[model samples]
Structure formats: C-alpha cells, structure tokens
Target: MKIEIWSDIMCPFCYIGKHNFEQALEKLPFKNEIEVEWKSFQLDPTLDAAQPQNTIEYFKEKKGFPADQASQMIGQVAQMGKGAGIDFNFEKALIINTFTAHKLLHLAKKYGKANEMEEALFKAHFIDGKNVGDIEELVSLAGNLNMDKEETRQTLTSDQFDYEISQDIQEAKNNGISSVPFFVLNGKYAVSGAQPAEVFADALQQTYKETVSPFKDLSKEGGASCDTDGCSA
Candidate 1:
C-alpha cells in the first residue's frame, strides 16, 4: 500500500499528524509493505524567506487574530504537540518561506531519505527553532541524514527539484486540497487534519484489506472446479 502525505513543514498539526500516523503504522503487521511519500504544500507561499517573523506575530498580523487570541491559539497547538510527543517551541519558531525546504525534500526523495528529511525538518523548525529557509541549515540537516553535503548545498542553492516541488503543490490543488496534513491512502482513502492514532490505524487497515488482501470466496456451495482435468459443476 502507498500513502502520500501533503503537508507544510511549518504547520504544527502536520508534525502532529506525522507522529500519529507513524504510531499507527508501527503496530500494523504489514508495516514493512507500506510505502510512504511526503508531498510538499506551502501555507504561505509568498512569505519572505529573507525576513522571517515570529510565528505568533505572523499569525496576528497576517491572519488578523488579536494578540491574546494568537497566543491562545499557539498555546493550544503547543498542547496538541505535547499530546503527540512533540515539544513545540512557538516562541522561538519563525514564519519563513518553505519553498527551499521543499526543494531539499525533493532532493532527499531521490536518495530514498524523504521521510527522514521530513522528520528532521519538523524537529529543526518546531523544536530546535532552526531557520529552515537557510540553505546552510538545510544542508546541515541533509548531512545528518548521510546525504552528500555539497550536493545538498548545490541543490538548495540552485533550482534543482523546484519542478518536483511545484508538481507536488499543483497536485494537491488539483485534488481539492487547500489544507496541510492531508493524507491519501492507495490514491483513494483520505484522512484530513491531525487525527488520532486510531483513525489512522483504521484507515490503514481498511485500505490494506481493500487493496492488498485476497478476495473472499463467498460461494457457499462448490459451484465449479477446474484443475488439469475436466471441470466439475
């Protein structure tokens, strides 16, 4: 079974969703058979990467939320992160453009390290408060994954993988997805938002049954049998 997840690295719920989804996958008997692909989605595609702003301030200024409401919302998200085993430090988190970060992910995908790359990016931004928009920071993260440091730097500096990033974003729009942390299972089943582990587990099991499991023979009586000999009915 294949699962494609469309998410933005800056989105708090995307990290939470990733953790919940992985937790569900860990318990599945056929977990090894599952293929997960992380797709790119930008919540703020036009944000200036050169001038990153505080996450709470960005929410208040851009989204028109009051100061107290913004803090409350961020606090709620932090609580949600804790529930998913993530320590989200919004105070240190910055709102920066993720276009370059997404390109790095595409490069990592070529090396079969996209999942690892996504996890590292999430931790870098939400936990460690690293500037994901910075090429050097991204290269360092890639190096930690054993990816070639120079190749990663070149890829981030140039337009390499930009096409793949755009394609992923366009595909999300084509699928009517305007939100982050959206999951598509077997190109059919979709679970939106940061749902609980049970929801993901149920979706995974259902998709596996429908797509990978053998068909059931519902015939009560033996209707026909054919082997290397004559058929019987």
Candidate 2:
C-alpha cells in the first residue's frame, strides 16, 4: 500500500502526526509492504524570509493572538508533542519561509532519503531552533545526512525543483486540502490532523485488506455449480 503525506515542516501537528503514523506502522502486520511518500505543503508560500520574531512573538504580533493565549496555545501543543516523543522548543524556533526546504525535500526524494530529510528538518526547527530558510544551515543539514552538501547548496541557491514544489501545493489544492499533516492512503482514504495511532493502524489495515484479500472458496457460490448430487454442473 502507498501512503502520501502532505505536511509543512513548520507545522507542530505534522511532526506529531509523523510519529503517530510510525507508531501505527509498527503495529501493522504488513508494515514492510507499506510505502510512504512525503509531499510538500508550505504554511506560508508568500513568506519571503525568516522573521525576527520567535514562535510566541509571531503568534502574538503577526497572528494577532493575545500574549497569554499564544503562550498557552504553544504550551498545549508542546505537551502534545511530548506525548509523541517530540521535545518542542517553540521559544527558540524561527519563523521562516519553507519553500527552499520543500525543494530540498523534493531533491531528497530523488535520492530516497525523504524520510531522513523530513525528520532532520522538523528537529532543526522545533528542537534545535535552526534557521531552515538559510542556505548554509540547509547545506549543513544535507551533509549531516550524508547527502552531497555542495550539490544541495547549489540546488537551493538556484530555482531548481521549483515546479515540483508548486505541483505538490497544487495537488493539495486540487484535493481540497487547507491543512498540514493530511494523509492519503491508496489514493482514496483521507485522514486529517494528528489522529490517534489506532486510527491510522485501522486505516492501513482496512486499505490493505481491500487491496489484497485472502483466498476464498469461489466454487461455493450461489450460481449453478458442479456438485456430487446435482446435474447443474
């Protein structure tokens, strides 16, 4: 079975959703047969650069949330993340445009390291508080993943993979998606938000059963068939 996940690196729920999905996969009997593809979805495509404000400040100043509300919201999300094994440090996170980071994901997909790339990017932003929008930081991240750092830097500097990023966004739009951590299973089942691990596991199991069923006695049908006492053979 194939699963396509549309998420932005900046989305806290996306990180948590990833963990939930992984936990679900661990419980699946056919986990080894499942394939996951990561797609790009930017929270702010028009954002040009990294804002000077941290997450709390961005929520208060840019999003117009009250200071106390912003802190409470982030704190709630951080607590949720902790349950999923994520340690979010929103106070140090930088609000940056993720277009280039999405592009790097496309590049990583080509080399079959998309999962690694996604995990690294999420950790950098929410945990390590690295500027994901910066070319230097991105290149360094690529190097740490054993990818070609110079090649990644050149790709980020240029307009490479720009169309792929746009296409991913357009695909999300065509699917009527306006949120991150959206999951599509077998091009049919759609799961929104950071659902529970059991929900994901059930979806996977249902889709797998639909895709491939165990052997059944087709000869014991309602139609005319051969039998020891019948001439309707």
Candidate 3:
C-alpha cells in the first residue's frame, strides 16, 4: 500500500498528523508493506524568505488576528501538538516562505531521506526555532541527514526540482486540497486533518482492504481445481 501525505513544515497540525498517521501505521498488521511518500504544500507561497516574521506576528499582522487571539489560537494548537508528543514553541517559530524547503524535500526524496528531512525541518522550526527559509540552514539540515550538502545546495540554487514542488501543489489544488496534513491512501481513501489515531488506523485498514482486489470466480462448480479435499475429479 502506498500513502502520500501533503504537508507544510510550517503547519503545526501537519506535525501532529504525521504522528497520528505513524501511530496508525504501527497498529497495522502489514505495516512493513506500506510505502509512505511525503508531498510538498506551501501555506504562504508569496511570503518573502528574506523577510521572515514570527508566527504570532504573522497571525496578527498578516492574518489580522488580534494579538491576544493570535496567541490564544496558537496556544490551542500547541496544546494539541503536546498530546501527540510534539513540543511546539509558537512564540519563537519563524514564519517564512517554504519554497526552498519544499524543493529540498524533493531532493531528499531522490536520496530516500525525505522522512528524515521532514522530521528535521519540523523539529528545527517548532522546537529549535531555526529559520527554514534560510538556504544555509537548509543546507546544514540536509548535511545532517547524510545528504550531499554541496549537491543539495546546488539543487536549491538552481531551478532543479522546482517543477516537482509546483506539481505537488498544483495536484493538491486540483484535488481540492486547501489545507495541510491531507492524506491520500492508494489514491482512493483520504483522511483530512490531525484526526485521532483510531481514525487513521481505520482509514489505513479500509484502504488496504479496498486495494487488495480479491478475486472472485462466481462460477458455481469447480473446474479441475485443487482444494483441501485434494484435486477435483
């Protein structure tokens, strides 16, 4: 079974959804047979990487949320993250363009380190408060994942993987995906948001069964077939 996840590193719920989905996978009997691919999605593609803002400030100034409301809203998300074992420091989190970060993810996908890259970026932003939009930081993060730092830098410097990132976003738009943490299982089953572990587990199991495609003969009589009673005469 294949699971493709559309998420943004800056999205708080994406991290939580990741955990919830992982937990679901853990409960699945065929977990080893599952293939997970992380797809890129940008919450603010227009934001300038050069001029980053704190999360609270972005919510207040850009999204037009009152200061207190912004803090309170983020606080609620932080509390939800805590339940899923994420330590979200929204106050220190930087709100920056994730285009470069998403591009690096496509690069990481080539090296089979997409999961590591995603986790590193999430921790870097939510916990360490590192600026993911910074090229230097992205290069450093890639290196930490044992990826070729120079190659990663070069890829980001050029227009490489730009189409892949854009395609992912375009596909999301086509699929009516306007939010992060959207999961598509086997191109059929979809689960939105940071649902509970049980909900994800159910979706995973359901998709697995639906995709298995059980063979049905529909014939009433057996025709020269072998069975537990031995070959039919």
Order candidates by lDDT, high to low. 1, 3, 2
**Which candidate should be chosen as best, given lDDT against the real structure?**
1
Which scores greater on lDDT, model 2 or model 3? 3
* Model 3 per-residue lDDT tens digits across residues 1-233: 89999999999999999998898899889999999999999988889978889987898888999999988898899899989999898878989999999988899999998988899999999999999989999999999988999998899899998899889999999999999899999988899999999999999888888678645557777567888888875
Tell me the TM-score of model 2.
0.92
Report the C-alpha lDDT of model 1 over 83-163, residue by residue, as the tens digit.
Answer: 999999999997899999999899998999999999999999998989999999999999999999999998888888888
> Among these predicted structures, which one has the highest TM-score?
1
Clashes of each: 0, 0, 0
Worst 10 residues of 2 by lDDT: 214-223
Q: How close is candidate 3 to the true structure, as a TM-score?
A: 0.92
lDDT of each: 0.93, 0.90, 0.91
- Assess candidate 2 and give its lDDT: 0.90
lDDT of residue 103 for candidate 2: 81
> Across residues 83-146, which tens digit of lDDT does each residue of candidate 2 receive?
9999999988988899988888888887889999999999999999999999899999899888
TM-score of each: 0.94, 0.92, 0.92
Output the better candidate (1/3) by lDDT. 1
